[model samples]
Target: MKVTIDQDKCCAAGTCVLVAPDVFDQRDDDGIVILLNERPPAELHAAVREAADVCPGAAISVSEDA
Candidate 1:
């Protein structure tokens, strides 16, 4: 799976980070969503999807690899 985040749309809720710290993170200064892994390993796909689903700001985007 591929992950992407829109900083402009982020509300700094930190849900993504909590759900998938390996795939997402927060900037210490403002707690904005940060994309830690653009293309995470297969083992992390589930968490990445969960993060995208629960993102309050809808800042997380995921694309599955064919």
Candidate 2:
């Protein structure tokens, strides 16, 4: 799976980080969503999806590899 985040839409909720720290993070200064892994491993797909689903700002986007 592929992951992307929109900094402008981010609310700094940190939910993505909580759900998938390996795939996402936050800037220490403002807590904006950070994309740690643009294309995470297959094992991390589930958590990445959860993070995307729960993002309050709808900043997370995921695309499955074809």
Residue-pair clashes per prediction, in order, are: 0, 0
Ten residues in sequence with the least summed lDDT for candidate 2: 57-66
Q: For candidate 2, lDDT tens digit of each residue in 1-66?
A: 778889999999998889899988889999998898899998999999999999999999999974
lDDT for 18 in candidate 1 is: 89
Q: Give the root-mean-square deviation of each candidate in angstroms.
A: 0.9, 0.8
C-alpha TM-score for every candidate? 0.94, 0.95
Provide the lDDT at 44 for model 2: 93
Clash pairs, candidate 2, are none
TM-score top scorer: 2
Tell me which residue pairs clash in candidate 1: none
Q: 34, model 2: CA deviation in Å?
A: 0.9
Residue 48, model 2, lDDT? 92
> How high is the lDDT of residue 56 in model 1?
87
